[model samples]
Target: MSFKNLLLLCSIIWLGVSCKSEKEDPGPSGPGVPASFGFNSLKVNGAYSGFKYNDVNLKPKVRFTFSAPINNATVANGVTFQSASGEKIAFTSVQEGGDSSVVITPSADLKYLTSYSVTATKALKSKAGGMLLNEVKVELITALDATDKFPVISDEALLTLVQRQTFKYFWDFAHPVSGLARERDSSGDVVTSGGSGFGIMTIPIAIERKFITRAQGLERMQKIVSFLKKAQTFHGAFPHWLNGATGVVVPFSDKDNGADLVETSFLVQGLLTVRQYFNEGNAAETALRADINAIWEAVEWDWFRKNNENVLYWHWSPNFGWDMNHQIRGWNECLVTYALAASSPTHSIDKTVYDNGWAGNSTFRNGNEYYGTTLPLGEPLGGPLFFSHYSFLGLNPTGLTDRFANYFTQNKAHTLINYNYCKANPQQYYGYSDQCWGLTASDIPNGYNANSPSNDKGVITPTAALSAFPYTPTESMKALKFFYYKLGDKLWGEYGFRDAFSLDQLWFADTYLAIDQGPIVVMIENYRSGLPWKLCMSSPEVKTGLKKLGFTSPAL
Candidate 1:
């Protein structure tokens, strides 16, 4: 069927048919060691497919012992338990089991009743040689309870809701994933065809693990699987906006005449995000993966592959439209990020994608060229230039990590501190004009600055740009906390999160679309938590790509 499904089958085959046994001496402990008489198991008894069942439940316990003497020669110092996902599980009780064993219960409820594969270990230091340790694993199946209620929305549910919205906003045929209602102008037209209202699919999957349970997040992912199988293009590049009514590629010329690599990168991130859940024979994750693989195979990097002099060109309008074949920093940023993320060191992509025509000095400008570039006074780069923001600091998948990290970290911290301070003295900052205030921040106080367009002094949001912070978490978290918690009133909105920081300017559109929030939610989640990237690394396509890149570790 789908490549993702095929990969899932392969993973199952790999796990079931083969047993990989390492030869290194087992230390003080290893795999399985329950705290109680018998080990515990956690599995979804009735879950046959992705989000197929209503709910699941299970009981878990640990097995251990404590009868030995005070002589430090024999028994293990203590026992420790951990879940497969790396979270610690506390043992409930340590009572005597019959004559030789002991029983132990868990301190908290198991994360979710789906299927928890656990490992317990016992440690003992030895004076004679190396320390001694023992461990064991347990898999238990939990039954589905039709009467069990679904969870209510809470602050903790924000991540999960964003994820579901990511899938729902894009794939309308399945369960209704939630998100900000699509934004609209007074005339009722969507702001930018591909800008504010476009639904950003697959993004939530990339980052939902930061705040929600895996089962809760993926329950919404199945719709994305079904949606992507149906969305395709002949040349391979996914479009900037899928038609709101029919699910086909919506015709839009302002951006790449419809096929934009920047948008495609966001889609690619989403596809990779859901990949991890396909294991255990889940159909949806696998199906979606195959479509994504095909899409990746069909992408034409040739459009951006130019080198008129030595400088690289970014966006390409198939019809020679605006910014056609022009070199722009904004485009380069996302392009490099995607290429590096998808590249294999050994199987390097054809050099053509990086050799396209370069733009004139006037056309190809950056912050350095701001003084000469034709634009509003002190309004360098004008509107929300997606490419420049991600590229300038080297934050993309393939750019200079050190430089990008510095740029993002500094900017993010500055934004947080600004908002933190702004909260106290809103009157001083709020009244100033965007450009005046924006310029003042850089010219006078100098530290944190505002996003462009002057309208968003710091308040009006940049849906796409702000979301890129996931690539740099330490910085992203600072911005998010400031916007949501510190600058609470203006920033956070109802349908989904707003476009940018409120102090700059804030607007909440009625309908939620994929393009704006999808990448933001997914990437931010990944930054706060690494689940999405982890899942992508688990895929065969990524695994093969990494191996080709000369990596010894298994794919992500």
Candidate 2:
């Protein structure tokens, strides 16, 4: 069985502290009023028949009050939460010596989509030594917490479930030996440098969310950093792909068999944010931080400039040096490339490189309006939604500014345009709605394509909308509900929402991509809690680079 299934199975063991049913507090206007109720049994919610099948998350805490004070000592033997088959479900109870109410929480989360009964027998005693006349019971069914089923999982529950499941793509499915994230679910040993970086960013969230223990996260991180220390690099930059088990280069294409500077920057972005998160100065975390710093300081950002040119080149091949000759520039996902480039402590690029290469000197800038939204940069309709995502995953875009733009403003405009285009449905796709919209690079029926207003593929990637939670909450939440509640049976899966779906062709992906999955977890959290943004922006290196590149922000 998978590790996730094993954890679920562990929750069913019979070691629960045991708890019972509940009752509502009998009362009058204030004090000095006599309470009217026969203390026959626990008056659970004021009705003895039993509660309607109330729904909650698996490990819900059920609280009930009584007409009189509860006998704390008698609770353990007097109450029991059990399954239909009479299997006793263990729980821990909380009540003070004279407290009128008791709260019970399952020792472990209850089975997803299962039913259980909380019963209080006449054996329950009141603090005044009064006994119950009969038994009382309450019924509850767990919320649909698994992908195999469906229920009205909305709001915070939906957000939490999405984060947990999408996180599994990195934690549960990561490469076994190297702990690296693969390019796609089926990529096997071909781990990706950029996506692995994204995966690294998610680990601290997993730890904070209690998805994994701190030691587990540390172990996984240690494995990844250790592998990168030994992995093949061109001038201290990791290649786009590497053999997870052997730390060898795996060419993207023949000419691309070398260090991919853009990908390396992405990897470094995740690493730097994570390094800040583990700043408690403990031995393990300290070692990890030092190792990450070594990797960060060693990148030859200046050398990637192709003989001191203003532009940063994307690839550097040991055997085919500068053969790819790809320059990192403007209004795309590579802004992170330049940000990290300028942020490097050792071999740092000049601020002029960013100005002359990424902006100011570049002509890709477009200030035109599309779909009633004016984009500050990138292709019309803001290229793919990922251009808004990739850089800002760690780098806080909100309130961030350079001479060029206020990043949050730029990103928000970009997202609305993408969202509006899908709503426009120029090509008339099947599932384009206010509640079902998002487009970006994802698997299309005909292969992979970057779906956007300009490159329409009738495909919708959940990440495109879901990751924009911080930029557009109401719309993103609508898209999330539509993906999980409406199209969930096919759209949701073991790892999370499947990679992408295209209803126009009656197609849906059963795949997950590292680059796509990471942002969903990080950005949703960036919306709920600015953890990544806070950590990334706090990096002195990032601050130095942003300042050198003529940026300013409250965070700075």
Q: Which candidate is the best by TM-score?
A: 2
**TM-scores for all predictions:** 0.45, 0.73
* Model 1: ten consecutive residues of lowest lDDT: 435-444
lDDT of candidate 2 over 1-556, digit per residue (tens): 6343455345323111112222243323345444322222232333332343433567766665555677888888878889766889998888743577777778987875456888766667777665653455667665444352477855998898999999998988999999999899999899999998888999888888889998998889899999889988888999999999999999999989998988898899999988998887789999999999999988999999998999999888888888877788888888888888888888888888988888854456778999898888777678899999998998898889988888999999999998888887776655587887888999988699988887887789999999999999999998998788767877898889988987654567988999999999999999998999999999998999888888999988
Give me the runs in candidate 1 sitting further than 4 Å from their true place. Answer: 1-234, 245-247, 254-256, 282-285, 303-323, 328-333, 336-428, 431-450, 453-458, 462-493, 500-513, 536-556
lDDT of 1 by residue, 84-154 (tens): 45566665433343322334455666543234444434443223333323344444333323231333345
Most lDDT-accurate candidate:
2
lDDT of each: 0.38, 0.82
Alpha-carbon error at 398 in model 1, in Å?
12
- Backbone clash tally for model 1? 72
Instruction: Show model 2 residue runs off by greater than 4 Å.
Output: 1-149
Report the C-alpha displacement of residue 366, candidate 1, in angstroms. Answer: 8.6
**Candidate 1: TM-score?**
0.45
